[model samples]
Target chain A: MRMNLKGQKKIINIETSQYPNWKICLINELKNLNSNNVEIDCNDIDLSCTDILELISIADQYNCKIISFCSRSIKTIVSSQSLGYKSQFIIKKPSDNTLKMNEKNITFSKSHFHQGTLRSGEYLDSPGDLLILGDVNPGAKVSAEGNIIIWGRLLGIAHAGSKGNSQARISALHLRPVQLRIAKKVARGPKEKPQLGIAEQARIDSDEIIISPLDAT
Target chain B: MATDTRVILICSGKGGVGKTTLTANLGISLARQGLSTAVLDADFGLRNLDLLLGLENRIVYTAQEVLEEECRLDQALVKHKKESNLSLLPAGNPRMLDWLKPDDMKRIVDMLKEQFDYVLIDCPAGVEDGFKNAMAASQEAIVVTNPEVSAVRDADRVIGLLNTNAIKPVQLVLNRVRPRMMANQEMLSIADVTDILALPLLGLVLEDEQVIVSTNRGEPLTLNSVNSPAAKCYLNIAKRLQGEDIPLINPAEESSGFGAKFRRLMQTKIF
Candidate 1:
């Protein structure tokens, strides 16, 4: 099977027999990317957790890309490996250890901090959602590649979607930060202390930083 | 007798919060009080201690050279001319970040402890690898902060990190404080900073332009006996660091009208 490139939009063939359950979602995302010329070549290739590395190697050699995976399959792979499952191992090519592909892109939906306080001069960087168990003191900073959820009082600087994802949000139990950066935009506090009670989430809605109650939805 | 050496790390999370200035002046102050002192510049990226101490040209061998095996440890230590008892271990080239490792830092501090009465390490801003390496061998930590909200916040973070690393008795040095700002509620007071950090206050330095001039001239402020309030404050802080029970002086009240009025009255009566 082959795919044709139309302008900037590249069309690639997606084999569905190996992942029948996620065929529709994959097709929809591809369509959203403005890919029209897709050829379906259903081959009986069993891509399991153990074969992920080999699959990556093959993809690299063939110039193929796999953007998303079935959520259930990912959970199974992560859980099995975490539970000490032994499976087929594929040796990774030693290029740059920092640029290796990772299977689980876990989105942190919620987080909670319990006791410890983040002091000044400390930095917390997370890729998914974050929840601090304690207070974020001044001079301390927390940067999340996704949504930031602070369970305790936040008095430091918190940056959400540091990778420039504007859809990212930040929720905190007590929100009082020196500066809050979401995506490319930044909002500073210290003007007035926010009323504390329910958790509050801050997000950009049409280029404005809006802080609403957590229960707002 | 081989007394156990003490490595005191002077660190602040915020830049321009007087970490290097405190290091140089405090080293001189300690020496004046009869404690053999050595100031180590751990800010590898921006080596300013030599310039702060006016010993930039005197630095022949730096810590980088020592770490790289280009020079011996004793050869890298630069003794002061004004203060014979105080010495400085200047930082090497600005690009020598990876030269000092944790073990190497421990060995360096250990060696300094054996020779100097006090080893004060001036840590660079940020909680990066350099800060960790500096704190790794220090026996105690000194967090310097201004009375401003941002400085206090950073100091809090540094103190928390020190606690996490199990470095005990972390003291606070409040520098460049405008007492009037605190009085007007424009800035965080020394009490507020201490409360937030929950650390013992080492000393408080007032905002003085003379400090800048002294630093430019490569002299420790404490060496200026010409009625510089900042220098006097540093002297008192040095005494306090040596475990002296010196009373904490309030710069605002001390600099206010009472002494000035008395002196004026005496002059008028004599004339």
Candidate 2:
């Protein structure tokens, strides 16, 4: 099925073999299309991977822009490149990239640039290691499944091992936050003026988030 | 030249930190001081500022209505019956979040700035779309927290966001502080909270049951002068925001009296 809006055409193709919901596949296909001007309604059809790949191929053939895809099966979409999606598709793990590491989980460590200061109510969720060069200002939040390293002063809310990895940790040059969460437990910081001049790290210690000075030893 | 309206945002990333209560009382306090004040509830999904202030029944229209162009902005504003200078722009119905666009919010804030001396926005909990909407327009912020670790942690997160966003003059309001708990080393102290947050302290509110009662009654705690310690703190916060040189009242002293509370807090070694 396909729909066109305001000069932007959305061609939605679906296959209902693996999944029962065609609407979900249609939504995913539309998202992979990547055109903001187009609107799609896929309430009636079920979708398959072949159908999605075909849609992407068609989009490429027609040079049509795919805007956004909202899907319930985030893991499936992330693992398979069959969606032919682009533009920082924050996914758990892309199956195409799976050839590199199967024994240990690979941590992606690249700084994500947020143009303006993070305001209250903004949150960043990443799967691998996160390096925020900017300050973690108050009210902003950063959470990761792996370790979180902040080069700037950490003031906002941060969570490491959001996926229940107790070994994950959070580190910052200046660590002072409203709250710090590791795995499931939450902890607040050095209840007094943090003695500056030393780097700090926080990790879960027996179900409690403990903040201690980084050791040079 | 027109005076720039003071935009004070009451924000805390942690939920149930009395942010809405603080916004309502601070608005009432400022209005009682003869300044025209308006409290804007930015908590889109769950708006309780109207109920907390006992203005829920009087709400004829809401900011959502204004945003949808269903009514004029003036029509959505509900005036406080007792205080002529105090008014509220309540959050719209459940679907209010959908209609809340950033530019429309900015327009509403700009319009409020033109009419009121102070515009206090009660920010929603968490760092998400709702919070971004509230902080986008504010010039200053007040992070509200309790004397608990979780609340403090959330406040820290909020402060970081404000700093990153370049929201100037961010201050801290330490709410629901129990002096007895702090004295017993069961809860965090004022110095401990300030040290971790590293922001200037604006006011420290004591844990008073009267605050909850007043909220339940839909009357501002400031109106319950006899039993509300939180009211005094809110009043002082208002004065401080207005650039008044009011002395900071020590929470320990109010709870345990000056000498005993000081001695007990000193024993905690919170310096």
Interface RMSD of each: 1.9, 4.9
Q: Kindly report which residue stretches of model 2 are placed more than 4 angstroms away from their true locations once superposed.
A: A1-217, B257-271
| Candidate 2 docking class | incorrect
Which predicted model would earn the best TM-score?
1
* lDDT (Cα, tens digit) per residue for candidate 1, span A148-199: 8888878789999999989999888888788889999989864676776878
| Per-residue lDDT over B220-264 for candidate 2, one digit per residue giving the tens place of the 0 to 100 score | 888556534567788888889888988887655656767655654
lDDT of 1 by residue, B94-138 (tens): 866677787888878877878878899999998888899899888
On lDDT, the candidate that comes out on top is 2
DockQ of 2: 0.06
lDDT of 2 by residue, A13-32 (tens): 45464447654554456556
